[model samples]
Target: MFSKFVIASLVGLGLGIGVGSVPVLQDHLHWNIWVFVPISGLVLGMLFGWVQFTCSSLLNLRVSTRIAFAFGLVSALAYLGTDLGQYLTLTVAVSEPTEVLSGQTPIRQLISFPEYLRLEYGSRFIKTGTFGNEDVGYQLGQVGTTVTIVVDFLACFLVAFATALVMDDTFPWCQACNRYQCKTTSTKILFADEDRLYDVLDKTTELLLEQSDHVKVNAYLDLVAAEQYLVKPGDATQILSVTNYACNQCDNKTMVGKVLVKTGKNFSEAKDLDFMLSGTS
Candidate 1:
């Protein structure tokens, strides 16, 4: 648990520094390093963690390093697959169009009229060669084809190589390697914070009681104290509860009031803590 907090803090700190130092990331996007570095780190860390756990279980690998390597390789392949899919879908939409306007093709074909005719009438157009009918759909670009098998082989090799380099040092118990644990601990902290809030309110009540006279203390003051003392993550309902009580009293007396403003601001701050605790963006 302590390690998770330390890891999250470090990730957040790194983000702050990276965002601040990187002129391109900051200048072009008009976003501070503090805004993106920790945010990006946390999100990336979670993504890596999830992939590690799922792949490890599926492959029955006990080593975190192996899982990270496998997932990183898969990420590379996914990137390649996405790129290839887009290329094929856009370049070879001839056969799959639902609104088949039979007159003319909307996209310019890669195989122009000359190439089409050459293949259509070539004398050696024997039916069993590399350019055979079985391969015709691919040759005509009727179906999308990925890069050559050689290129694909190289891609997989490179993916596996890169994965091994980057993730070979990871440990299963490391905070950087497991996001599920981070989320669980963060949730526990949030709930714990909520449970401890009543004590804070009680202390505030004791102080207010000391200051007030024999006359009834205005409920609004209690609400104000609640909002001001809400320094921790959990128990946001205290803010709403106190604010609602104050609002009800104010409404009956037709008094000028604004519990909502205080509550809204505190709510926004409280919301950030949840993400911070979760080690997620």
Candidate 2:
């Protein structure tokens, strides 16, 4: 577990540094750039969350709020690292020897890091409008900069946090084997009868439980049923989704069931229909 944490931290740090350098380099090259957008921060946070999830899945690391908090902190540090990289690059490119406050201390180094960060944050501005057209611009000052930093950091942190929570709640795990389970099979049944949704879901769940208990039994009947229902010509109002998961190292297996209601062209999960059943093969 400790080794997994160490690995995740190292990976996150490297990713942070690598990603944080892009904007700095872009700005240095005078490219058309905008880096302080909240959406950009959310996207970056999701990327970090994905990497963290991949690492955890590969390492069989347990997901928890503690782990999520650590990831959030690392992500924030990565954001700060981007600013630090920008500041250092700008200082090096623009500061001359005569710009030093003392004998050898550069003027940029004279102030504390936080003060420098505030100044940098205050210098950023947002512009909205079409390209090659009139645009409206808003620049941040002391208070606005502080608020923007807080809001941006919170937005990024919340995304990473929520991603971790979703993984913990939805991903199948084998408690006895102390590892994540793999999805072995998934089947969906479409039905148009809204009144019979629960009845069909219950029957399907019962069939799954029975099949799961007798691992030696052939699943041909279930597949035939799925095919029969899927090929029906009429539009489906609700879908009964079933998925099976298993642990390779043990006999532990899980069956998950959910109902999704068709909304226009997409299906959304129905509340109170999600369930999981575990048994030994």
Candidate 3:
């Protein structure tokens, strides 16, 4: 298709540009002014283009400029998001507790004890040379640093280009979507007599929970428990049927009703039985 061709061309162009910029990037990676940084985008473009061409042909989709641009944009955005996410996780170094004084009396005497305390939000405190009079309050200000504007713009451009090349509406598992979705991998592609996907999910969830903070673990445990109760083992037919049946009920009442109708009053035997899972009914 014409669209496919455009995608291919743009990807090729981007890849060429990126390949052209590598030496420049190498030169500036260690420099003071970031002179060679511009080439990173070009390199990213070229690499994205090659990937797009290979995958597009496999999927039987035509390469197009629109596709390339869309991929590029998405890729750039994904990179940007990842960068920001890393910054958020890593920027804060140390935190300490501090108490604030409450209201004082008219005579300049202390009226009440401190009601609350503040802790640094993973931000660091720096020690600079003391002045004639040292101010303790000014130390927290040293922690927050702003990311450069040039870096942000470059990230966006790369995201847009990469997104265009790699995204496909049909693939639900793609990270391009705001929701947590995953594409069906080879393991999931072929249907077998027994389904091991839940086993995989269980292991993955366990690993994730082990690494998560207290608050996150609590929330994740609740969700994982709920999901476990809803899932059943069987062939694809049973799995699909159960999934569809659960999805169709609008509320707890509806879900209960559906289960009763389908399971012939065996719903009482179900573990972790909750109407909330079916829907709002």
Give me the candidate number with maximum TM-score. 2
| Minimal lDDT window, size 10, model 2 | 24-33
By summed lDDT, the worst window of 10 consecutive residues in model 3 runs over: 252-261
Q: Write the per-residue lDDT of candidate 2 for residues 18-43, one digit (tens) a residue.
A: 66456535342211235344765686
Compute each candidate's TM-score over C-alphas.
0.24, 0.74, 0.25
Best-to-worst TM-score order: 2, 3, 1
Which candidate do you rate higher for TM-score, 2 or 3? Answer: 2
Off-target runs (Cα >4 Å) in candidate 2 are: 23-37, 84-119, 130-136, 208-211, 214-234, 263-267
Better of 1 and 3 by lDDT: 3
lDDT of 3 by residue, 18-126 (tens): 5333443333221212322344444454455446655565445644457667655544543333333322222222244235332321211222112100122232243
lDDT of model 3, residue 218 = 34
lDDT (CA) for every model shown? 0.33, 0.67, 0.36
Candidate 2: clashing pairs of residues: none
Model 3 clash count equals 45
Off by over 4 Å in 1: 1-52, 91-281
lDDT of 3 at 77: 40
Better of 2 and 3 by lDDT: 2
